[model samples]
Target: MNNFTIYLATLLCLLASKVVGQETFETRAKNIAAKIETITKEEKSALKEEVEAVNNQLEKGSITLEQAENKKKVLAEARAINIEARVGKEQENLKNLVQEKVDGKISESDTIKKSNQLILKWEKGDKKHIAKNEKRTTSQFVFAAGLNNLVTDGKIEDSDFRFLGSHFYELGLTYNSRLAQNSNFLHAKYGLSLMYNNLRPTDNQNFVINGEQTNLETNPIHLKDSRFRNVYLVAPVHLEFDFSGSETKGNKRYFKTHQNVRLGIGGYAGFHLKSKQVLKFDDSNLEATEKSKGDFNTSTFIYGLSSYIGYKETSLYVKYDLNSLFKNNTINQNNISVGIRFDLN
Candidate 1:
């Protein structure tokens, strides 16, 4: 080969070697940082296990409280010493990397600077590791209120229906089970709720169910109050999605407290706990109230489709019953409700 061609090939080989050396140095720096983290985590875990063992011994009456306390102090001091020793060793390893300079292909100053930057990056990642390990299934309490009504295929001719007093309230405790081990994007949400649904007919009217048929009946006296009430104990289950990102505050830790958008779609099945009606009238300068409690031809089993769309704490809630409001009723009326829901997490 010509002398110029040989020189060009040699230049390319040198350039490739330099690139590989730089990559190797960076990789080794990351490995060292990762090893240091793993060793420290293992040591902390051992210390926790030691403390737990001491507690177990004390609980079993094998050691007195004072002795257990002393043992805990000893274990803590030992852990501190272990950590100090490991940290010193890590520093020594880094110093050796700076001194050796990886076969002198890279300068010692450049190696130290690059290694320091890599170590800082890995240190920041430690918080992410901790968050991943700590994250798990969680739960929160919820409250909801809205307007409710019975929509039917048949209609009552002489009654004027209104939505003012036809309100519903629900209180529940909900739990979220994560679908993936290290993710909170998709979760299985389930909860137990107590629901109260009320409907008031306009123009002094009361609900009356005759045998298997249900309808609203008008009253002759000027009725001051008339309403129908039903209570339910339900278990709701849904698939909930959280569209929120993690943020770091003043501290270098990541938190997921701000869920900006959330959606839950699911169904619920419940049992009718009770059904009642109240009536009041003024007669001959006397005011009297009467209450009736019975099945009222209402369905005992309740199942429905429920959903909510939320931004932050407040959400619009909706529920539609699949079955008729009253069992074996001719009118075939179903209940529907819409309202707002709040999450207290």
Candidate 2:
């Protein structure tokens, strides 16, 4: 048989040995006392194995004799403490079991039920123990992707960029801090993010840099694809209102967020990292691709207004750049995006 099967058989046999019919209070108390003895024996046996391993390391010159002695001392003390704690816990259980038996709160059949429960606990690992103190600030990963376009002189309809083809994406980390000690209604959310914005012209047009202006003009070749992209590293902050409420536990209150409806109004400011343009077309019946990286008179610093509204981790998001897309254009244009945002805690 495999080791797991053998281990399970041993547990079953140990439990079977404890099974009894119509046990008196004294008998149950004796069983718990026997378990305390077993705990001590198990811890001592484990200590013996650890000491043997330490001795083997010393013999192999992997550890000095003094080191081995120190390790043995620590292991012995740890095992002794473990035995005392385990036995003390069992003794308390014994006291409770006996008291409950006398008070008629526990029946004879409960002994078997308790034994089964112990076996189940042995099969499955113990549940994790959580601390009482909770942190006030938590972090989450932010990701957003959606359609990107440009608004010219505060008009989206007059924009030259194609609405369907343009796109924007943002990836970052954000921290949410509760503004009030006992309320979950408000939070200050802030983070650093990288933003990517791409704009594709409506016609077969590509950006041309004039002496002092960046303008769109028809490509000489039949353009298969033409795109202008800008990358920015920005720090965003928001005042987020969460309607998730709070829960009380043992004289302390814990505020919860991103569990219900949430609204965030924020803005970001950052410097432009890069701007590039890409063009692909047929050159003399052969497919050709061209890439150009330059400032293209685009703004050096970028700041934008952004907001989101939705339930839980996901929300409908929108952002609009306040600065002009290009510095010296005849009519100023600003980048804008609309999409879905996800905050993964």
Candidate 3:
């Protein structure tokens, strides 16, 4: 017989023999191997057993030869069905076990495969096409500066906003230095900034309450004749993240100049360094300045949350001072900035 036909016949015939013999799993596998002679030998044994039983019955005159042959055929078919069902059950159970492993719904430690050990051994034995993942590290530094808008909540009034450079201005610089890890593409950094601001009441008062210096205005300054301004410095340390595994992207690291908005709220302390007044109308500058000190207290101290947003290289962001500038200070100039911020990595 051709090999394909012979192999198929052996598979079917071996199943019948295996069931007849009540063989264990290991022995059945060995007997049903690719050796054609070994497989046919088991089939032959199964036929022999039937022939002896039939002959014994014939001698006793219980049945004819034809009856004996038909009985053997029926027994072989039943044996084949039993073995096929057993094999199918075993295969289905194995498939279920594999699926349970992938889902992680399986909690039993005994079921886990020791696949990592095998992988390690194989990689070590054949030193080809294998690499280990390591902690990343680096130190070449870079940095950038930018401006943002300012908004504030006041002690006496509700709230207001101003774009950078108009009633307000900001300057910031960031430094990305290397960590001590000694791996590739990994590090840390420190950031710093200085801000200036000017905020005034929307309406000027006809009468003034000189609380600080004792010079309230009468015919006080015209509503248009009042102005306010102040300045501060801030510093922050930002833990940076990066993706520069390949070449051709340039070595300049990533600078937060444009795109991608960043919202970060940390602790900050600002000292009111400068305070001044600009005359709005024809009156004494000292008198109007004294009456219009709404949100801006003389050298007010503030602490609170800060946040920002950016697009590619350009950004728009705002900060909310947590503390009041006035004793009744509600919220003051929030330092909303929109300037280029570069990175050093």
Candidate 4:
């Protein structure tokens, strides 16, 4: 099987196990209650340390997605086992004490009071544990693909643009942090991304850069393909508003990879990594290819404003660069792109 199929199979198995096992949670929790009571405080601390270590590995990208998911399963199972054990032990103790009260070893009033206190204690502990687990933010790698184009200052005819041939793509890692301590509606997302943008001119034209001047020149010969590409290594930060009641806790790590009806607005700044032009044509009936790489007189830096709005993994994305495409070029063509964004958080 392919890697994707294998991963899917493993994930299905894990999820199935959780579902099948969930039905026995009450029984298992009762059975393990005594064992949980026997666990020392130091042992509980050790468990926390182990979970923290796994989280560190995940954040550092040292573990694969499957590995991270498996680790999370292990941690959850440990917590469940601990919770069930404690509840079971408490129930057993309560039963024993009630039996004593029935035998007249304790006063009826005293027995009632003690039983109520025990029940309250269990509820409080369970609530605290559940609250702790719900507040964590999960981190993962993301890959996005989309189309791109340029928005110029002066009038550029639509016929002079090649939208399909000009493609824009990005790959990056993102961390989502809850804006409010108790609410997941607002979030702050920050990450480093490598963005590639290709611009293809229409009407058999190619980019020509001389010193600080950059312009599109029509080819003397018939051209099969003529493309200019710019690459950027940027750090982006966004403020996201999720109206799906998706709660995120900055202090804890939880795995909820996608959101419905989410909107994000952000800006990015980065250095221009490289720029190149490629030309392909038929020379004397023989296919020929030429690639030229240089300073290109393109801007050394790039900054842009970007936004996205969508449901689930796919979203409409728009980005507009504030800076000019070329540093000192005669024509001012700012890079602007509108396309679909796939976010695998």
Q: What are the root-mean-square deviations of the candidates from the true structure over C-alphas?
A: 25.2, 22.8, 38.0, 19.3
Q: Please give the TM-score that candidate 1 achieves against the real structure.
A: 0.58
Residue 13 local lDDT, model 2: 31
173-213 per-residue lDDT for model 2 (tens digits): 68899888777788999976768899999678999999889
lDDT digits (tens) for residues 112-168 of candidate 1: 566566568667765665665346565555667888887776443332456767878
Worst 10 residues of 1 by lDDT: 3-12
Q: Which wins on lDDT, candidate 1 or candidate 4? A: 1
| Winning candidate number (lDDT) | 2
> How big is the positional error of residue 256 in model 1, measured in Å on the Cα after superposition?
2.3
| Window of ten residues with lowest summed lDDT in model 2 | 125-134
Predicted candidate 3 versus true structure: per-residue lDDT over 1-345, tens digit per residue: 332233233233333322322223213333323222233235446645876887799889899878875665455444434433543443344344334433655443422223344356655653341221222332211112333334444332233222232344443344444443432233354443445555544434232334542221434445445445555545554443333332222322222211233333344554444445454564445433343333224434545554433433223444555554444323343443333332212
Q: What TM-score does prediction 3 earn? A: 0.38
Ranking by lDDT: 2, 1, 4, 3
